[model samples]
Target: MRALYQIAFLACILFSCGCSDSNPSPSDDDNVPPPSGTSSFDIITQELSNDLTIDIYVPRVENASGKYPIIYFNDGDVFKGAIASLTSYKFEASSGIEPFIMVGISAAGHRYGRYIPYNDQWIKENWSDYSPGSINYTQRLINEVIPKVEEDYPVDTKRRAIFGFSLSGLYAAWAGINYPEVFSFSASMSPSFWVADYAIFDEPRELSNTRFYFDIGTKEWNYYVPMIESLENLGFRYGKDIFYYEVPGGIHAESDWASRLHIPLGLFLNGTPEEVEGYEIIKECIPSQSTAGLVFQRLNPIVTFTNGIRYSLSTSASFQVVSGDGVVLEDGRFDTKGGSMTVEVSHGNWSEHISLNNCNN
Candidate 1:
């Protein structure tokens, strides 16, 4: 999102003879490229065994900026455009999650023809002709693509991620499962794990540093349920091996996946794949029993810095950052909503205290 700036220029025409017209500050009307300070991109063509075209989205950054994480999608055709559509960049522009360089690999149509797991006879019998036998695509991604993406982008290979849906969904899981050494996080939406014979978990070894997100709609599910059930069972056995989400009245359309796309995207890009069971949201809120006129309308998630210091919260609808330490750095209203916030804070050497005002009299 670009910031809107309205610079008004007032000209006093005291000696313009006949007439005087008010002229405001001329705005920047050039067709300049959006600031590439946050992200940029280039097309990569690989002349390997499987000649492939990789669409890399380079996160705009400086050399001093440390490495960022990578999130790759297999069915690039379906998932690439999804990046901008999901406003992932906008979310990054927001304060909570960290920015990531997203790479969407367009399936050049060979998607179904080439990428499938196990190449088992049962897969061929049940779901079309699934030629499985160590998906070479995974190898390309891990060995070649990873290197290529890392070479071009400032990426931390240790924090790589992969995600997909349907056919590629299965590819995502299989690649991450079979080659855990490559992807740190993975998510499968309505994966065809049921397409194969032996269950996904049963055919695996101890998973390391790999977190999975399994999601499916509850509606329009006649055969998908079994796959979901099997995954849930496996997750139970494997603990945080999977992050399962049973979307109520879920559908197979893009609308459903669209609604839930951010879940996996965020998780893969910036979440700990920890085993979570019976999630209970504990909202320790200081009720807005304001007896005064000033009050907050909304309160987003409180931000926690890696420095082990937690920010103070104001209310439910939105929280105002009172201060970094205890001194006020910003005077008057400081906002963080609609991409901005109003606040008053103090500045100090290392730490200061946050003093919040407007508590109902």
Candidate 2:
């Protein structure tokens, strides 16, 4: 059932009613013409006998000439297709986003080793398969890739940004946190925060001018909420320097991430938050539907704004047992007594009621 739903969602993303008329399909082949007003090329970097392919995309702004900001992407080969397509669409539509150079750094064959942090214990345990080269990879990117690009192109070095998803998303966050001087912005899409029991949080972080954008799908497990809270604890404000988005009905697939890529791109390039006129609250019981004999674990209230940005109000929202014998635990979970129960959840000016029935049919 879930698989079928995901297929349908992907179809909506790929072939939405007006998408064909508005944005043409992007080509995956390098030999094909690149996005309009954008020049594309590739570079090879050899490190430790591994050849890394880096794809570069530079958007040409006619009648306006100045140094453009640059965004570096991990998992170059996989994301370049979507990046190229979106670049073309934005250009054709006159999206008003500032021009920027894109650098897509391919992980090549050392993805697992290069994406994970060097101090991660998982890589140490699986030393044979994933060589100890994460630190080296980071160094190469900072010292090698950035230098090569800056030397060849007219770029705004101060406004550099890093972007990645999943494990590579973790890398993007790590780089931004550790080297804010190098990357002023970082966009992490569904990062693997559970890696090495969340050891990334243990690393020391200093307050800086760096901005971060984080997001996860509602259909996916809530592994990134804690990371967002951690950033808040470090003095990062929502919709300001740090942004967290809960994508409604989104999944862990690349197609899902590709569809909403414009959100981060607009935020970083234009430096404006989408205006919110209204919002809808989506209540989801952790298990959705559970066996009658099972206990209710958790209830998640996701607030999705009219701007299409969603947020999980689980930690900050107030949860109260409205009517039922069920008890609201101190940890915010409801204890069902094999009967129907209703809970009222409130956040800011919004309130919603969620009813659960554990009674056997």
Q: Report, for every candidate in turn, its global Cα lDDT versus the true structure.
A: 0.47, 0.62
Candidate of highest lDDT: 2
RMSD of each: 19.7, 8.5
Off by over 4 Å in 2: 1-50, 62-65, 91-94, 118-128, 218-222, 272-274, 285-321, 325-347, 351-361
Task: Estimate, for each residue in 234-324, the C-alpha lDDT of model 1 and write its tens digit.
Answer: 4423223445554545554444565567677666655543322212111221222222342422111222234222211211112235534
Q: How close is candidate 1 to the true structure, as a TM-score?
A: 0.56
Measured by TM-score, the strongest candidate is 2
* Model 2 per-residue lDDT tens digits across residues 64-172: 4578788899877655554565565444335565567888887664666677785555434433345445667778887788888888788888789999876678788
Provide the TM-score for each candidate, comma-separated: 0.56, 0.73
Off by over 4 Å in 1: 1-51, 61-65, 91-94, 120-130, 220-241, 272-361
